[model samples]
Target: MNTFRLSKRIMNINRTEIADLIYNKIIENRSAIKTQFLKTNETVGYFFMDDLLPTELALEIHAKFPTTEEAVKRKNIREFKFTAFQMNNYNSLLEEVIYAFQDERIIQLISEICNLEAVYGDENLYAGGLSLMGKDNFLNPHLDNSHDKDRKRWRVLNLLYYVTPNWTLENGGNLEIWPEGLKKKQTTIESKFNRLVVMTTHQKSWHSVSKVLKDDVRCCVSNYYFSDTPFLNSDTFHITTFRGRSSEKIKDIFLRIDNGLRSNMRRLFKKGVRENPHQYKK
Candidate 1:
């Protein structure tokens, strides 16, 4: 198994310290954060950090991780499935950092920043663990699956921790946010090392990961928080649809047809008649 070491200093900050940083940042820029996501300014807001993950821990996790199967489905003719490598069931130091994310301090800070009350998962650790993505893999633009285990609440926030050392823009594997609708254009978010991208996910939040250009894996930690209420003012049901970039014509058509079928199935069978195992449970 691949293995590496955790940093000696940064790892000692503890959960309380981390939470405080998140809280202070939110209070300091509450209005700006809210406007960034809600107003006409922009559909997405981003926050970056150079040391969110202790370098040693990040390196170690990256070394010891295993590659996951690329889950693929036909979205359209040229458009294919959201294929990528993922290892959610974490071992090594990976689990420690991921679970620490749910600390009450951090959650409260995130809730305040987004101007929403923080409600967490009770049945189990709805929070996710570590994940790794390799070359040629891609995640298509789609709405996140709403609700946690048992459909008890609405899943509102997505906290992503990217930890690939020396990951450069030229490498490609970037996070693409399609806030203004795919037909218009897309805003690409760089998956920089130690960067934490916390995004608002509701019925309208449409996002995806671009295809990786190199053979090196792009590793990340993925987490989600659930609330008793939905984030959107209007509660609507939309399937997790996928589409090709503006240029892929025939592929786009096929994906639209594929999305329609899945969407229709969900209408008839509340949960789409299939269990989505992508989520985290206790």
Candidate 2:
């Protein structure tokens, strides 16, 4: 059921109202979130907040989210999921909410809370926008690509807003952050409804999505914020590296070799053998 649809007038404005909601929520919770990030800053700093929007709005967004058939299926031993970045092809409300997070005020506020500088939003929605995972879908532990599409800026942070109502830890498709590496125990952050999780992205941040254990399809809105320099001084450029879980001993080794080969390829080719087709073409 289409629970709600933005009226013509609501879609024409700057979406300041939703942006204000995001800004206010983050402002009210800024201190605690800052402390939380600090607590884990030595490794992979991250913090999450629930009820990020009005409950009814979140549910309405979920209802309008595109089905798996309407998305781009990305499946392989490394990962299995559906992603959509061409925001114009979907509900306009989704695009509005997405760019709302990009609002100048919200970006500045996030910078203040996360102690970051020179941050900017991606209007192209590079490797972001929407994600959906269903039964058996999973993303192996990996570090995001270090830089933006053109290698002009460092990809510093990832924002994920989930809207699936009644989602639970048991349903899987949760964010797993491996602060230490694949050998160490990782942290699982549930992808609950109306929750927004912000995580620092750079070297030592190996994270993934657990396989969906149930038939439910998990939907998420994602964005990445880039900066003029690395969030961590020690960080360097690399491809989107992936590794199998520790249990998959052989797959892990294969992935390691693959990562190395791909890293070398990037050094030689600069832009890779081909362009990544994950960004908004327009």
Candidate 3:
């Protein structure tokens, strides 16, 4: 498929149309949305929306997602999932839809709803873009990295758009937000189709994904917004921190040690030993 034609057909100012749809939805429900975020932000700082986009459009985006073999696999204790940000490696439609969220209007509306200032979309897709979890894949509770790819701006918000049609709670692959800490019961957010979840990422905002129980895959388009200021006034810099569930005591100890070692390395080497190959080059 010609990249240009594919993008044109799928995106077709569809990027603008999607943004417009989101903007209008926000406008229509500004009071309710703001109230929801305000209440949740007091505890964990998060919000979610259902039927975020036209179901058919989201389904088309999901249909264009590359297979797990085409994405970078992270099969470590911290996580087991497939992610792809090298836009050229996938269909141009994927690239168009991903960048569409970066549109300024969408960014402004999101910032306003979240009561944030100076929020900026990441064009580089640092740790953003597309994510897939198949059977047994899971992400341990963790705090996102404190900054952008260059470590210049503070990572403040995480935007995840789930598009796997007919996904259910029993299917697993749901997002778990640890508002009070891992020892307490965490809030489980179902990864339903056409749902968009936005959460604040700070020093204490811990979150993870449940293991996929079924053979089917859970697909999502992700994006992060950064700002010049931290989400919390007391927020300090740190690497992406991970923690084991409450039941996994030994795993928790080991993960703490691992996080300590990585944090120390980042302290000595701002950019770490090597660059993270998770960004779009072009």
Candidate 4:
């Protein structure tokens, strides 16, 4: 099989090989990534690596991404995007890449760099998987739900891998980190093609994606790493909370109330009002 050739069906690429490539790249920039994360430890710790995968493989993945129309559309004030968690329904190669990050060695390396421990991967892809955003799609500044689907583990790190070739600054959908709370300035991380971003998820790690300025779809493969304990002693249970951008004052009020109500309900219900349908059933 010609590894460089593109086809209707992706050639079988071993996850171990993919993991090795990722490991090497992280190793290559270990100092910078580690320093970046450590310096921001008090706030939202993060670091990104460009050209995460080889150009050929990255383009192939982008070419195989299911269109926005084919995935789940989540349109509302809080966010507007499409997400796909059920990997069996997508290209086999997509599944391979998603699981490749879950490779034990990669997890350990990431854990070390972030000064975190016992970080484990989610096989079920709970709120973690393929997401695509086209024009006007935006994710508000928010904290991820504190725990995994079962509420047993604390979510510690977020992994985002971009495969959209030629994605640019003019293109919105870039990751925005509000390190000094939402009122202060925000740090924008371009969702550059073939880039992988890793960030610590704690109580103060508020982040969002800028609205897509172009008609093009910004594609990303996302995954989360959980730990046995919370990243900070102050971290506590909270649902996936979101707040409107500064311009939307009314929305900000509504969302805050909405968050409070949800938190109250969770206190009463414990597990939640019902099962969250976001996880991969298989």
Candidate 5:
């Protein structure tokens, strides 16, 4: 679809009435939501809400997702998955649902629950969009890139909405957060259907996804919020750092050195040698 029409669809999705309804549902559970996030925020800073949207609507969005062949593949030691940000590549419903999280009311509610300030959603996507992982596909432990596309705002939080119906913990494409550190045991958050997970991302938040055990594809809609300040005083600019799992010692050492080299390159060239290709063109 054309950008003009796509923009209209996004706007329609955020019409005041609809936005208020979404806002109210979240606000009604605000106390519980805040408690859940605060309980973990001191360690890793994350929280999840099941049934973030109406199940039928969430299922419709998932049904509209592009197949693996239609999305871009990233298969390397760091991760193996499919991602797509170009809005035109998917149906209008997918675009609508993605931007729905960008709605100002929703943003305000999320910021309040997380006790974060000056949060802003990514419009160009900038590595925030749709992702899919089939059997054997996995993402290694890693920290997200520190800044926005322009290197202006700090990437503070990651918002992921899982819509694949009937997904379970045993399915294995769950989110793993290393609250204490990679050396310690990690917490597993199941990629449950129609769930929305919001997690803080700073210099030390190390997270990954377990390998998919089922033959099915797990699909997710992702978005990032940027801010003027780091989430913690200890936070600083860094590349998208990666590390091998606790079991892979050799790969861990190699990735540590690899991250150091990439960090150096960023220090010298603020924008890097080339532009990041993972962004919406319009």
Candidate 6:
């Protein structure tokens, strides 16, 4: 149980402002946005501090959060996850804030940021919750699968709202983006507190959570929005693959094998013969 002071920080753009920004950004620079994404060979784009929340309140939410090893092991990657835990809609303030996030304005903003057409949004908020990773916790590079419940729609964007006050690069738990493959070094994205990162999630968007090294927990609010169509015209099917960084050869081989097996099974039994229990149902 960690005890910390609570605080708040409001942003210049609230719900109304966010919607207007999205619409205007889309209408103004559609061609430039599309061209940038195509040339980068990356599925997503990022926007930061677009909307701000009360810092003290967010810290209080973090203070009250339960720290559980079992939960982290179940949801986190091993050999890393020294301290990682999460709670979903655990309080009214968080729920209210999350609910406000479902507005069309916010959704459109995300779509336009990624230069994609607005398709659909997930207000039900399944798997879209709070996640905390402390010293040593890490997520390996992987591709987010392409669909939502029952393969109904394509999951195009991953919105991460980080809120760890005074967090720094040396604290670890940075996000590594592998625009190229594992053979090439990755581009590291600092998970700055109060900063929101909206990235494209598709076959080529290989990313992972770096290992944390500080005593404080790096907290983040995770959300995913889906659309009726895919982000790429030449997108191919694949599983959520994982890979070790350039150094860990053995781990990389094992993970690749694991991904291959799961992918093969999915292809043989379209829609994955068994129901995926990770879905959020309302």
Clashes of each: 6, 0, 1, 0, 1, 12
> Candidate 4's residue-wise lDDT over 83-168, tens digit each?
98888888988988999999999999999999988889999999998999999999999999999988999999999999898999
lDDT at 44 for candidate 5? 82
Tell me the spans in candidate 6 whose CA falls farther than 4 Å from its real position: 1-44, 69-72, 75-89, 124-127
lDDT value for model 1? 0.64
Better of 2 and 4 by TM-score: 4
Kindly report which residue stretches of model 3 are placed more than 4 angstroms away from their true locations once superposed: 1-14
Query: Candidate 4 — worst ten consecutive residues by lDDT sum?
Result: 1-10
Full-model lDDT, candidate 2: 0.90
* Tens-place lDDT digits, model 3, residues 104-141: 98899889888899999998999999999999999999
Worst lDDT window (10 residues) for model 1? 78-87
lDDT for 39 (candidate 3): 90
Candidate 2's TM-score reads: 0.94
Q: In TM-score terms, which candidate is top? A: 4
Q: Write the per-residue lDDT of candidate 6 for residues 235-261, one digit (tens) a residue.
A: 766667787777778888888788888
TM-score of 3: 0.95
Tally clashes: model 2.
Answer: 0
What pairs collide in candidate 5? 41-45
TM-score of 6: 0.77
Better of 3 and 6 by lDDT: 3
Query: For residue 76, what is the lDDT in candidate 4?
Result: 79
**Candidate 1 lDDT over residue span 26-77, tens digit each:** 5666675556655532454444444554455567656655555433233434
List ranges where model 1 is wrong by over 4 Å: 1-42, 69-90, 121-128, 279-282
Candidate 3 minimal-lDDT segment of 10 residues: 1-10
